[model samples]
Target: MALTFTEEQEELRTTLRRFLADKAPSAAVRRAMDSDEGHDPLLWRQMADQLGLHGLALPEEYGGFGGGPVELGIVLEETGRVLLPSPYFATVALAGQALAASNDEAVKARWLPAIADGSTTATLALAEASGSWRLEDIETSVGNGTVSGTKMFVVDGHTADLILVVARTDTGTGLFAVDGDAPGVTRTRLETLDPTRRLARVDLDGAPARRVGPDGDASPYLRTVLDLVAVALAAEQVGGAQACLDAAVAYAKVRVQFGRPIGSFQAIKHKCADLLVQIEGARSAAYHATAVAAEGSSELPVSAALAAACCADAFTHAAKENIQIHGGIGYTWEHDAHLYLKRAKSSEQLFGGPATHRARLADLVGI
Candidate 1:
């Protein structure tokens, strides 16, 4: 089957690209990454208020545009194109999905509007001190509507208005939403290699929380949320990969070597060709996963896993090769090649990494 973009999708993509080009050019991205907040709040507001992006995937009742996973995938892909330094992915892609999957209407009513309007930023506090993303490995305890434990590498943890924490209860793993400034909640930002994406180590010392769903049957819901995240992230990976490929190709045509353009060299030509092939393949995988997510079919899980793993590898490989094609300039901090590389690495590890997804895909197929 072939993947085709709807008119709305094409329009959305064009608007976002123009917005980024005007508001967040490469210099602005570099400045944001170099800033303490690691992002620009003004640009975020433009994306939320001006574009209504925060609400794109939310229901209409929640002040959203009533779009679904496919819309979100489109937004993520555009965000990847410019490497927009914001927490939209962590907030919308993961936390929004977590809330949507919750069984509690009260929680949804309270949080979804804020999220949809960009009045609130939320993140999933799932990865523990052991840094394991599995439900079984979540050792944080939830008791008496209170939670206690340390959640590491929480995306936007420090900046979130709310935190959806996955903690272990007596019954099993459960989802809880704790206030960002709730008492007993402490945070420490890690000095990470990727400055564009912020992560924090969150410590919950019996922090008061509102339980969103039951504890025992969280595995299935968790899988669904993860699949949705993967679908959107795969689109982002493909976008990043395509950006890298274009950069490499453009540089090869312009950069001179041996008294001739690098594009004339057989080695650089082969490298660009390989990168283009990988990007096309990754685009196919990402489109398939997005379709499966939108359809909510039984094949969603396997397709999402396959797409996530393949996109991660493809994007990472293409990004590294792009830098290599740029030679010494790509390695410098002054160049934009490293930015794509950092994003590729961070995104690859976001949803349990390639190995994790491949293993999950294998198990999902009962192989």
Candidate 2:
């Protein structure tokens, strides 16, 4: 597939890129990351209430734009480009996708409206303390109207208004919705490596559990949610890699070495050339996956896995090369290169490492 964006999509990307450049510059992102709430409420409100980005990909019944994954992919890419320190990915890409996969209309009617309007934020808690992404690795149990055990690394778990808990049921894993402030539920913020992305530990002591899908065999729904999330994340990685490459090239043009621009050197040229190749390849794969997702194709799993591994490695490579290209200044805290590097490293481990996804792809394509 060509994986080209429509004119409307290009316009959307331009608008969001301009908006984030103005509202979420490196200084703003740093401030938000260090703030008490760990994000800018006002900025988030503007992105949601003003731009209507919170509902961009949701159904019209839930007060959204009724768009598909392509729109969501655009927003996520812009957010990644600027390192916007909001719960956007966790809320929209993860939780929103999960809720949309549920078979229960009553549950959707209750939750989707609030989420669509930006009146509420939510996250899906799937990874347990073991930190495995596999569905079978989940150990937190839910049965007889109760949930037990704990989940870790829940994005925005501390501040979200709603929580979607994936629990071990009698038949298999089940998706449950729990009110954030419900009794016997605890959320503690973790001191994560990347402060821009919030991580929380959620402990549920017989907390209320309501199955969002059918009572038995919810793995298909979970897989669907994960595939959607992977496509979004891959796009984000491409954006970040693009930013890193831009920064490196810009620096190479200005920084003089031996009375000439460093970019003229064969070594620097080779590094930049290598980065460009990786980023372009990753971008192609990511955009293809996003396009496939918009079509709701059955090939999503293989595409998602390919995009995930390709984008993850590309972003990490670009970040590291960006720092190396900058020489000394990139090593300091004052520079923004490290921020992209940190986020790139964190994102690599978010769903699972690149190696993990490649392994999954091996089975997904029967290689």
Steric clash pairs (candidate 2) = none
**Model 2 lDDT per residue over 1-367, tens place:** 4488889889999999999999999999999999988899999889988789988988888888898788999999889998888988888898888887675788888888888888889998888888877888988898779888765569889998888888888888888998889987999998887888988999999888788977788898788888898899999999999999999999999999899999999999999999999999998899889888888889999999999999999999999999999999999999999999999999999889999999999998888
Against the unseen true structure, what C-alpha lDDT does each candidate score?
A: 0.86, 0.89
Runs in model 1 deviating more than 4 A are 214-216
Counting clashing residue pairs in each candidate, in order, gives 0, 0
Error of 1 at 336 (Å): 1.0
> Which candidate wins on TM-score?
2
| Runs off by more than 4 Å, candidate 2 | none
Model 1 TM-score on a 0 to 1 scale: 0.97
Point out the worst 10-residue segment of candidate 2 by lDDT: 144-153
